[model samples]
Target: MSTAIRPHLSKIVLAPMEGVIDAAMRARLTKLGGYSRCVTEFIRVSDVLLPKRVFMRLCPELAEGGLTASGVPVYVQLLGSNPEALAINAQRAAALGARGVDLNFGCPAKTVNKSMGGSVLLQEPDRVAAIVAGVRDAMPADIPLTVKIRIGYHDDQLLEQIVAGIWSAGASELAIHARTKFDGYKPPAYWATVQDVVHDRARQLYINGEIWTVADSYKAIQQSGCEHLMLGRGALAAPDLANRIANDAVDQPPMAWELLVGEIEEQFLQHDCNSPRHIGNRTKQWLAYLKRHYPEALQLFARLRTLRDVQSIASQFTAHRQQDLSI
Candidate 1:
């Protein structure tokens, strides 16, 4: 909690990382401060409009006025190539009280691509525009429609055209992940490439990629020339990242390793994620990211890695928290 503050110039959004950043994580992170908004993991849309339960299961925040507990608006994200199906689904999400709708054209999973969802659609910019326009037309004009995408599917050849299509289709905002589908999560996000693309000033454009720290945030902004950002694994790696970047205060130390471990233990014991069998699963998965920032996570992960039973993990939490008494 260092007082060092530099005052950042743009918005910091919590990126949607599918299974990683769910509602509970959103609540915890948003409550910590500095995120302008959060986007839910993509809700897969296909031939038919999904049931209301599907939307509820993915984004329970919709029940709370589409805002996280800290009042950060949560935008419902839909992934699909079918314009009609996506449109109806987007409409349903809005009806269910979504603050906004985001179209995901950037996921790189082979299974998702094989199904003609995610990055596979980048091969056809016409359909991309059509999908955006369709979803836009179906939802209320006041409900914002945002689009997220990689530079391209296999290469960035269509990057310019695809971005133009998204804006022309009336997307309220566009977040570019700064890589091609083939690039996956590789390093060296070509933030500089985005500097060359034509951007719509009237519409917000967000640059997203390997932004793991405050220094990287500034570099990405300087290179991409985009004022805003969407943080993904980077945010999980350092949970207070959005605040640090916005406050422009890297001098402040990150959340104490012990404090963060305490928070994870509490979140773990809650058991409110995907399923019962997956109780400690999210905590373990998160440690995989946390280890990148906090070495303590690695030691804790080693102890809890093999345990799935609640009692076993809870016991580990007890031992971990006891270290505080010694201090």
Candidate 2:
């Protein structure tokens, strides 16, 4: 059995991919093992009070040990620049059975950064402190409040200072994305930067960025000497990658085609939409990274995109898979 450095840190956390890591994705990732925790995509924090249904929709697993089907605890992630509003919403989420709260400070979406939310907060360390303080104060003491952040907004000049501010503001832990807001998922995640933070600060560090394979993850752990890691695109690229890391095994991951097809069928089946069009579109988005795992994934996605409707696309996908299996 794998042991975590801290009880809260999962050896593998499915990165919070907006629109891609939905309830269905969460359920599938849970079954794959190796993932210890998962966070929903960032929910917009509005100045106006949100309806209760919104909270339920954001975290359906809260009713059952704050975990998805695979029993991994899922944290509800909130994204906004307003400290007070974010705090209020954090409390509401906790009261509604949320086990933990994750504040988003690293989202690089143009709309989000422009709205003074997500990675934009990195531009103002003091404001980030206030936001963390407010949410930490509002949430229950037992409920851990964590924050995810990039190095800086446009430059890394303030990265160390921002990390300090988050810690001072009562954040229980921090997951560093190992790059600046401007890096925008580009090449080279600056992993060494994260190692510097862990070596210098007393805080627990979870490495995120460019860890696509077991070897990549191992090298990161070796370089940083930090055990905890968070996989964003990596886990999606290979569902069983985490199991390989947790077991310290060198086995290649399971065939990506098998996992992706199964996840697509399972997620679409859960919806009541007149057709699976909406869900099918979601699958295409994930294929951005998933295809790299299985070359055939691109062909499958291309076939999916050609269809005009979800039902037809789904039928084609299923029929093709059945044919492949029979041969």
lDDT of 2 by residue, 137-195 (tens): 98899998988998788988888788889989998877888888778899788877666
Candidate 1 clashes between residue pairs 3 or more apart in a chain or in different chains: none
**Per-model lDDT:** 0.87, 0.78
Least accurate 10 contiguous residues by lDDT in model 2:
1-10
Which regions of candidate 2 deviate over 4 angstroms?
1-10, 200-203, 256-260, 271-279, 322-326
Candidate 1 wrongly placed segments (more than 4 Å): 1-8, 198-203, 272-276, 323-327
TM-score for each candidate, following the candidate numbering: 0.94, 0.90
Could you list the CA RMSD of all candidates, in the order they appear? 2.5, 3.7
In candidate 2, which residue pairs clash? none
TM-score of predicted model 1? Answer: 0.94
